[model samples]
Target: MNPITLEGPRLTFRELREDDVDALFEIYGSEVATEHLSFDPRPLDSVASVIASGIADTQVDPRTVYALAVTLKEDPGLIGYARLALEAHRAGQIGFALNPSVWGQGYGTETVRLLLQLGFDQLGLHRIWGARSPKNAASARAMSGNGMVEEARIRDHVFTHGAWRDSITHVILEDEWRQPER
Candidate 1:
């Protein structure tokens, strides 16, 4: 399988590595970073396991999961985690989280754009979608900014943070994606 590596104007998406545990921990282990994610902040050991699993997933034939590291163009340190899981009928589900320190920057939108590019341009997928917590306006904006339309609200979608929570799904078709110039 080809290793996934994508470059945008401000960021790069690369295959996750075992050594990325500590860097990824900066996002996965932070309450603020995992606030809108389905799960709570992960422990350091959990981060290691997550990275390990991601590395193993890449080696699977006909790979269906892309769990990548988001890094700046000039720096090769992991600043965020991005995932795209392929499903049947030419569709994929995407999710992402960034370090809290980089929250306000345009990285989230760029990450979404890169994921769309990967699904449509690279993977030959027809539809790509992502779900975000209803209250996560930042995630909503990021997906929308990348041409993903808000499609549905699934009630009781996930039981997180001690209660059932709804999720807002945003989707884009391969034809509908407006690819950015390289």
Candidate 2:
């Protein structure tokens, strides 16, 4: 696949590079940002290792992952990341995290919309899904804002932070997404 760069009104999405390790580490290394995530806060070395592997994927498998860095368009500073993980079927699963500094500024909703557009419109995917910890109300609203419907509450779905956590999944079919009126 060609290198895909998605442009939103205020952000740009592209493959993360080795040089982005610092910014990525800043997001992942923070306890506040990573609290609801499956993985714990990572060290700088671990982040560098992951970035090295991700950047080596010359042929990106949309079925596996399209991990992208979410950066501000004007300043080009990395705020966080958004991922579209494709399932065995045609549906794709989306997720994102933002810098704690930018939490309530509508970036989350815009990020979801951009990923949905990339998955459904550019990738020709039929369905796109997202899941968030039941405790994450902000993520719930962001997914809903993008036309995703609550699908299920998967109890004990994932073991994180030494305990089983519940996850609520949301989905939007291609036919259900209403493109913005220009």
Candidate 3:
């Protein structure tokens, strides 16, 4: 798949680049930003690795990960990041994060919607799902608002933050995703 650029009402999603290191480091390393993450990333190499992975993704033919920088359309500055990890159950698994300061303002929801748009509409995928910490109601809401339905709650499925944490899996199939509500 070719590198993509998606536009939302309030943001732009594009391929990650090497120059995004500084902003990515700040967001990924922040305490507030890492609060919901499984682990706080150490800035020295993680950011570079993400960019490198994205670059590598662009070269492959069958497409793997769609790692994008979520930026303000007006400013073109990175505010967060999102990815579609393809090849999961013959579909895609969506994941995203944002600066804590920008939390609860609907950007997360829009970002997820963009991922769905790319996966189902653009990429011709059959199914896509999102897995999130059960405690994060906002994330659940985002998934639901974008036409995903709760499929399961796996108890103690992932070990995060020094303990096993439950996760909620939400999914939307291509046929259902075409509904006007999306």
Reference-based lDDT, each prediction? 0.91, 0.85, 0.84
Model 1: how far is 164 from its true place, Å?
0.7
Per-candidate Cα RMSD to the true structure, in Å, reads: 1.7, 2.0, 1.6
Best candidate according to TM-score? 1
The candidate scoring highest on lDDT is: 1
Q: How does candidate 1 fare on TM-score? A: 0.96
Clashing pairs for model 2 are none
Q: Candidate 2 at residue 60, lDDT?
A: 54
Q: Is candidate 1 or candidate 3 better by TM-score?
A: 1
Model 3 stretches astray by more than 4 angstroms: 88-90
Q: TM-score of every model?
A: 0.96, 0.92, 0.92
TM-score for model 2? 0.92
Residue lDDT tens for model 2, 1-182: 65768999988998878788889888888898888887788899998876776566536543367888898887676798888878866889998999999889999999999999899888888899988899988999999988899999998988877899989999999888755641
How many residue pairs clash in all the candidates, one count each? 0, 0, 0
Residues 1-182, candidate 1: write the lDDT tens digits. Answer: 47889999999999998899999998888888888889888999999999999999898888999999999999999998999999999999999999888878899999999998899888999999999999999999999998899999999999887889999999998778745532
- Model 3 quality (TM-score): 0.92
Q: How many backbone clashes does candidate 3 have?
A: 0
* Overall local distance difference test of candidate 2: 0.85
Instruction: Point out where model 2 deviates above 4 Å.
Output: 61-63, 178-182
98-178, model 3: which lDDT tens digit per residue?
877788899999999999989987888899988888778888998999889999988887776678888889999998988
